[model samples]
Target: MAYQPPVRDHLFLLRDVLEIDRYSNLPAFADASMDVVEQIITEAAKFTGEVLAPLNSVGDKHGCTWNPDFTVTPPPGFKEAYKQLCEGGWTGLGSDPAYGGQGLPHVVNLSFSEMSSSANMAFSMYPGLAHGAYSAIHTGGTDEQKQTYLPKMVTGEWTGTMNLTEPQCGTDLGMLRTKAVPQADGSYRITGQKIWISAGEHDMSDNIVHLVLARIEGAPAGVKGISLFIVPKFFPNADGSVGARNEGVKCVGLEEKMGIHGNATCVMQYEDAVGYLIGEENSGLKLMFVMMNEARLGVGLQGVAQGEAAYQAARDFAKDRLQGRSLTGPKNPDGPADPIIVHPDVRRMLLDSRAVIEGGRAFLFWTALHGDLMHQHPDEAVRQKAGDYMGLLTPVLKGYLTDKGFKACVDGMQVHGGSGFTEHFPASQYLRDCRIALIYEGTNGIQALDLVGRKLASSGGRAVMSWFAEIDAFVEANSADEKLKPFIEGLAGAKAQQQDATMWLMQNGLANPDNAGAASTDYMHLFGLTGLAYMWALMAKVSLAKIAAGDTDPFYENKLVVGRYYLERVLPETAAHLAKLKTGSATMMALPAEAF
Candidate 1:
């Protein structure tokens, strides 16, 4: 089955739920009226469906070819598809207009991103990584640096990659052995071997700009000593044209990954590659987070995208594939056997995927709107609040979504049975592609830790408190609505569980950090369930209003049904998470090294 972008859902979220048009006062939204946004999404859907979806299995089969000359040839059709992507100006949709971009809202760009990832996750990495790099430079780069690189990057004439993990360092940048020595020309000589550098040496673009993190000579040890440098594969001249090859920047080898095979995950060798400083020296960790946070959100979207694609494949198969008879009786009496869709268990699987995926979509879009407000809103207090909300929810979006996304993919595969295990169906491919989302952009465990340890206490818990208050206000406002009783009740219960868990962590984690570490994952999920429940309540509220206003659209009706299903079937997981969180770390750390 061809992948279908969920354009209707996006529209529902944008217009009815988020009401992005209300922000027309922001510069980015000046041209993003509903009609314009709808047209853009429609075109994006057509492009992804026509150009990228078919190439998904093609790329997976052939993968990228690495040559002895340190260059990479992407799977066939990728270069052409990428060319189309650039020509369509999709790469610069959310970029600054001063540098040849469309300057659309980040939420709009994210919706398109979800579609692209669903079509071809491997192919999407080329531009996705470029976008992140563009953001880093646009945020932290000097004026000269931005003028030189941002335009080309925005145009997709030159691609970009980030180099952080080395042979000895994965998440711990303090242990990185990569070194950068300052030179006479105010540049740095960066010498390092970075591992797992995606889009490191691909031939799809004119030049590859690398954002590298390295420790300058004689700097203080650990993460504080690190700095970011702009290390390109080829130097750019005064005219912004490709110049001499930066010596020692080479792709030594590619990592044979479990999935996303078309993307070149390269072992990059940088030996005295010329690099320019980005932002202030020894402040690389602080600045690198700008890129990391963006990438993390993108990874979360990757989870949703893969789950959407997998669910479509599964749902279509269930509706058509003939199998065992229905328990209630033969709905398809004329056929040999009723389609598997008649089975309760199968419906359960489908609904599980649907509930999580749709809820996650709302969560992502809501957070993205907060991101836009944080960046573009004129009001300082509003920006600060938006930023805090983003901080509080980033972990849930990344950790919870991907964790559930992988499970959703597995459920999709389970729906396929034997065919799912083989490559004959796309279900397995989606499963493979989604597995990485959980591990990258900081593992889900790390995300959980960050949520409990840092974000929970950020601004003295202002963000979390505000989040609880928002839910409280909603529940209180809807208490009189009989149509919303079930949803309100379920959401209220989940919110209370979340608050209790938060308070427990606050009380217990202060005495022993391990309690926080042990409870982090569950707390994150508990927080996630509460978040999704809140989304469902909001969605259900809008849906009820629409139905009350005499709108007979099945879309609104289906929204209410799905929201109900989530509240009844999925949101109950909050209890389990809360129970586990209350268990603390006593037994988890009881074992000694010798016992293992």
Candidate 2:
């Protein structure tokens, strides 16, 4: 099945819901009028759907091959397709203009990435990781370092990867054993085996810039001793040309994975590989998080993108696949049986996926817009609030969206029944590919903990308070509008439950650490529900105004229907999460280790 980019939905979002032109004063937005934005997104859609979508199945079937020369070869058409991807210059859509990039808004770049990721997830990781690396260097690198690396990375001449996980450590940086010894020339010799390094080594780009995490020699113990290094596959000469190969770094092995096999997931061995320090020693985690945070957002989008592809597959299948008759009456009476679309149960599954796919996309854009505003906004207070919201919402965005997005994938497959289970269809690939998003860039469980353990209390809880206030203001302002009463009421109700849950945690969680740990996941889901409610409200508000003006577009009408379905069906999950979470850890922690 060909992947169709949701260009229309995004245009509605940028034009109607977000009113992006309202922020035209921002440097990037100044050039991003709706006309230009539409053109860029439309072109991106063509490239992704035409060039990239075709390779998704090929990438899955052939995967990548590890060779005797320590090089991993991409699937049959991957090399050529990657060349076209670079030639098209989609990788640097959101990069700084100073570095040979178009310098579009981050959300616009994210929208482009959503299509590419949907079409070819495995291949998209090549540029996705590079953009994350570009961001890390752009933010923390020295002027000389920036001039050396950013331009080519932005141009896709060089791809990048982040080396964080090792044999024994996944999320705990304190357990990392990678070592970096300082040389007389001020460069560090990085010696470590990094595992699960995506885009670690491939034959597509001229070079691979690795952002490695390692401990400096004789430094303090645990994570305090950690540092980030810039390790390239080949050294760059004084004139910015590719120089001698770095023999110390090699892709010693590749992991045969569940999905996304087209991209190389390598066991990268760095034995005395020359590395330049990023920022300062022991401050590496801070700098690396710039990429980590960005990657988490990107990963969340991966979940949504995969869900979208799956939903498209499932919806089409339900409409065409002959199944049992509808309970009410056979809509396709002339046929042997009604299409699955006539069955209410099948409708339930499709609606569930649609609610999440659309709501999740809006949540992603809302959070990303705050990211842009955090940097580009004029008012200090606005920037501070935007920054605070980014920190607080990132974990929820990651944890909740991926969890729901993966569920959407599962439902998508269920709608297909047996056909979805086989390799002949794309559902299996989407399910497998999306599964990893939950585990990488920090697990969903960890995201929940971060939300409850850290983010909730940051800035003396001002961020959460601000979120509450924002919702309250919206509800109050819209209560008088009768047509939007259901949306406003649902949103207000969800917000109240969220507030109550927060107060419960503050009251009980401090007394027992287990309470916080046990309630974390549920609370995270609750947070996600409220966030989506807020998003749906914003979308509904705009859609309602459009309809009131006598605009008869069915798009506006369908938006209200989906928004209502979400409020009635999906938003109610918050109550269950709240009820379950309030039970605390007593029963959950009662079982002894020996009992298991």
Give the whole-model CA lDDT for all candidates, comma-separated.
0.94, 0.92
- Give candidate 2 misplaced runs (Cα > 4 Å): none
- lDDT per residue as tens, model 1, 1-596: 78999999999999999999999999999999989999999999999999999999999999989999988999999999999999999999999999999999999999999999999999999999999999999999988999999999999999999889988889888998899999998999999899999999888999999999999999889999999999998899999999999987999999999999989999999898899999999999888898899999999999899999999999999999999898889999999999999999999999999999999999999999999999999999889989999998998999999998898899999999999999999998899989999999899999999999999999899999999998999999999999999999999999999999999999999999999999999999999889899899889989999999999999999999999999989998999999998999999999997999
Residue-level lDDT for 468 in candidate 2: 96
Which residues of candidate 1, in runs, are more than 4 Å off?
A: none
Clash statistics: count for each candidate: 0, 0
Candidate 2 Cα deviation (angstroms), residue 409: 1.0
